[model samples]
Target: MRLTRRGLLIGAGAGGGLLLAFRLVPRHYAGALVAGEGERIFDSFIRLARNGDVSIAVPFCEMGQGVTTLAAQIVAVEMGADWKRVGVEPAPVSPVYGDAVLAARWAPLWMPLAPSLADSPEGTLARLHAEREPFQITAEGTALAAFEAPLREAAAAVRAVLSMAAADQWGVGWETLEARDHAIFNGRQRLGFARLTQMAARFDPPDPPVLRPEPAREKPGSFPDGARPAYPRLDLPAKVDGSFVFAGDVRLPDMVFAAIAHGPQGASVLSSYDKAAAADVKGLVGVVHARRWLAAAGTTWHAADKALKAMDPRFKAAGRIADSVALETRIDTGLRKGAGQRVAAEGDPDALLAKPSLSARYDVEPALHAPLETATCTARLEEGQLEIWLATQAPDLARRAAARAAGVRLRDTVVYPLHAGGSFDARLDVRVASQAAAIAKTLNRPVQLMWSRWQESLAGYPRTPVSAQLSAAMSPDKQRLLGWRTRMALPASAIEWGTRLLDETSAQAAQDAAHGKADPLACEGALPLYAIPEKAVDHVPLDLPLPTARMRGGALGYTAFMVESFVDECAHFAGAEPLSFRVAMLSGQPRLVACLQGVARLAMWGGGADASGQGIACQRMDLAAPEGLRSGFIAVVATARQEEGAIRVDRLSAYADIGRIVNVELARQQIEGGLLFGLAQAIGGSTAYAAGLPQSARLSQLGLPLLAHCPKVDVAFADSGEQPFDPGELGMVATAPAIANALFSATGVRLRRLPLLSEGF
Candidate 1:
């Protein structure tokens, strides 16, 4: 029974009876944990040592998101382990650690046809596909939703076995014993884990172990203002002391450093280079050339970079070059002339919006990820086996790509995951792994590839540029919205990204397959938060020369700006206060209403009148979780003023309701970091393309906000007691609109484009 993608698709289209029957069969995990001497393994998540030390395996990548600490905290609380003895390590790639939640959320990418059949983690199709592919990629904030339950269950099973071992000694029922403080007790009898681990390994854990009444949760006021975290981040000490290991920090015996140069946007063929110039540099090993890139290796990275620069490699453009003017023209033409594909709708929006009362256009330029660390990977191919050290969000995909590049079997590839300085969803791309593997195979030695800042700008994909027109039909009084429509023009960014990620296709091939296709992921958050009777969201796909990928905030990063800014304009047109106008329409969402009112009170409740220099905006995100849809709500109030011919944001006040708080300090830090990241996007992080290259190649040229220029940020969370939601992207989605609206109040001018000053305000 050979299975292929084409056969599966054909079966799915032919009534899907075969696939349905296959899904009905129960599936089991077949992977086992590798244990060391004097250590006992519990499933695939926990390893207990004779020294009373516990090492928990985290499947998600830790790119400064506090995921390692959060995951360990759950296990610690459930198993009653001492926090001081708990540590975290990266989990091995196995079926047991597959992320079913992420697979279900991304069903459209893998199972494009009839995605509804596998749109849940529990669905057999979703679980089986995830396990088969071992899809444990760490994007979309699904870490907690996917792993929290299993981690708790694993810890509970360990506790049950240890309790049983202790009960055997005390001659009592295991249920009468409790496991806490690294010890199992029955009445006055106590046995430490160091003594019970060997005995516990001999007993079988009970089926369906009993879980605690409640999972780990921090109280609302657990950590007050200027207080230390209850459980400090386990990685903080090493990171602060310059001992944390990133991809670039990995070293191997007799390793050579390599630097690469990629062709321009429209170029693929490497035409020529000055080999003589590189030969003059001392310690230069050799030069390797690929179809689209050239690499030079040396004893030191500096020598390799210097030799590469001296060689002056050049490439020939194979097709049309990417230009900013041409990209903008395509967007404008598509918005006006291209036919739209309806992706979401509630009622007859076309009829209700025949005569729109108000319509406004918004535009956003392509933005960069600009993490502190560039793309870095180390690879060594020896004796038909490939070993790679990389910091990637998708480990299995990267290993597969690297194996193919080295011309080895997938089973022979070993990937060692490392920490990233910062990703912002940039590590999802695995091109560097393949490039490193190729270079190492060519050189027949260990090689570490590092992309220079200039090369990163020339090769990295930016967030898609978008142009949209929002139309609204209001009542006779012009105070209530009756109909709403959003017509957005952009490339099929989501499809392009998915093809490259899931299919391992080139950027050009992905773009070709995605051209003219309507992407629902690209139109996410276009739905209005307010209760409008009629609404429609339309997508106008455009074929562009430049490629695009996902960024930190995803689609809502831009859609929120358009919707919230337009809502502010409508409020002014109705001659009503901004906060009050929003509250009136938010009758159905009590959570959002509470956030808005709370933010108003936090920021002194000053109406956004003329010269008030105050602006308000709100956003709602519902992420797919195992139990159901988990939601996160946020509202931002910004104060801005013009000082010395510069826009100065004085303060930003935000209030959020993200259900139960797990780690209070970590949640607060995530919100603050998101606010700063959004501020950077609002000010800069964009570039203009000319002659198939970006005009801004250096970080200094991107006009990022300085620390001294950063605004005062205040964040507060609500005690909603709902399911916990990740607060990473909530603060970012609303920051741009709040600042733009603030600038509008400060000066009697509205900036309809991102970066506020792109049109030279």
Candidate 2:
């Protein structure tokens, strides 16, 4: 990957004498899929890969977050590359490559997720006024929230660079040329991005590339007011045709297949006994019962399965379980112990909650990613080194973690990340990969280990089991929010799974810290989507063993279900329609207000649906990020009831605010798919965890939204959309809450809990 000259100076390595030749710079990350990128270097290569084809590397594991497609779209848009040529691949997550690229890409308009550096009011003032924002500074908004001025400025900067280069080429004044509808023009003729790029490359790089002025505005691919033309996604065909190979799909000479299990889910295996079964099975290459061992076999995937079954390794749980109740008690105890930094202290929530106020508690059961292909890794031990293949969101994390497990040099290991069928945050390069590497090393042969469906479910990392408790104080008018308090139980680690809640030390501490407050996950967009000047938001994060990995919609979806539903409760209490109440609350958020208005107009808010029409919920969470994120959206689903009084979604219509939409078909699919996903979440994707074990294992028990249940889901685009807000994620956050809110009107019971069963609603 060659680096542009200007990029070279900015990415100078350790020493000055070392020019840090871009090729040697290792901008490309290496994985079992693509290994070589050392984090930061590989990211820069995305811009350089534009020649007739688009090529951009991603760092976030595709744990089904749709970051891969989103990242490629952002890069392709900026590079002036055609949708057909874009290449989306995963990058290594070098310790150096924190969440910066993602933040820079998706949330350019907003600030990064930084901690508060200011301990006092004075420091806060200085940070707010700093030229470059102070580090470790927590602001008074969303965890990753900020103004859109910077991203707009970046778009303007890019347009300016193109225009300046065009001016030099055409011998015209810089202001004489304006970038419009993806082309630059003066009067006579127009030059598209292809022409300007060629001219710009020929000219000496602007010591500081002529930047777009602050007042500069460039609508990359114009779409405003709920309309847009779809762009193309990077090489999605690679996966469709099997032209691309995944870790599980890897094949090699003398390579054996394997089906293995990790120490059950989160618990470690204290010991195992498989000697008898191993001896009885044919072609059983002995058994390795070490902390991590790979068992091998001869022919087919069936052979791998049979060998594992024959080995019959038995284990004992070495780790403890943490659940909701246990987590709460610990939090109460931890708060008394007084640990950790106080995240927020807002207008008297204590006094507010103590006063006459409505209070509600939300409980979320554990959810697994349940990807089509569970985390699979195949590895072959070569002469003194190892070669590996797998689908990973972060190959670098795989390399390092694998290197540690295999006891080899990082350079000797190669990882490949294949197209993901599904990843819901649990598949971020971790133990799954480590096991693959360890097995390859122990067997000293090319071995592939695919988690069995049972293993995949039982051992896979899961979405945290969260319990959100909220208390709200309303003014005499019942319009303005006087105050709010929230409490949340956090998963043990961002990646580690929490079997139960409040059963661990850290989980308890988190619960206690947030024992009473306005929880962000439960109260995010729901709070000020309208406007409340005197309201305060706070959270209690209970650290339990729940997996803190990425879900389709993490904080947004989980909390929105609670917050949005509560907003409706207040609206209904006021004897005003939900949409009208929200419109009244709109003060600081005009886009949000406008978005709500737009969705309501289409959904026919305030109208009755005898299963005919339903109100809508809207949020612009992705707007806080850079341009072209496929997340900012407005949803309005018309729900109708059958003779049985069951809600069947008739048709779902949405106006997405994704700045610049790429692959309109894919974007639509994301929304439609998200609708199905959310529908599934509302009606299907729920699981009950009792005594630390999941009750549902198969699709039959899990209740997925099949064709019979899902109705026509129609999604529309806002033509002026210049950003690429993520659709996969946005499809979910507002769904359950919206559906529940709609159901509340159709059926008098405000279903406070999820999995609206026959008895509950």
Best candidate (score: lDDT): 1
**What value of lDDT does candidate 1 attain over all alpha carbons?**
0.86
Give the per-residue lDDT digits (tens) of candidate 1, residues 1-761: 11222111111111211211123254444333566767766666787887879999899889998999999999999998999999999987776677888889888778878788888987888888888888879888888888888788778888888887888888889988888888987766789988888777656666566789999888656676468887899999999999999999999998999999998875456899999998889989989989999999999999999999999998888876778999999999999999999988888688878889899999999888888889999999999999999899998998999999999999899999888888888899999999999999999999999999888888888889999999999899988989999999998898889888999999889999899999888888887888888998999999988888999889999999999999998888888899999999999899999999999988986899899999999999887777899899999999988787667889999999989888988888888888888888887888889978988878998878899999999888888789988888889989999999998898979888987768676
Computed on alpha carbons, the lDDT of every model, listed in order, comes to 0.86, 0.52
Off by over 4 Å in 1: 1-32
Q: TM per model?
A: 0.96, 0.74
Candidate 1 colliding pairs: none
Candidate 2, run of 10 with poorest lDDT: 134-143
Per-residue lDDT over 1-761 for candidate 2, one digit per residue giving the tens place of the 0 to 100 score: 13233332222232211112222233322211221222112223343222323345454445434445655554444433355655665543332223322323222113214323321222322223221221111111111222222222223344555677788878887657766555678897677765564444333333333433322122423533245445533345665776755557678888777777444333445365555665555656534445633354545657666767766665555454534455455545543342333233444556666764687766555566677777778777777686667776545556666777788887787676665666654465356667777777777777777777766766655555555556677888876666665554443232122111111222224333433432333334433344544444444444454334446676665777777777777777667777767767776655566666667666655553334347466665643232222246465555644337456766665666654554556566667676677766766555544344456756576766668877766566665444345566777777777777777666666676665552343
Give the per-residue Cα lDDT of candidate 2 at 600. 67
lDDT of 1 at 659: 92
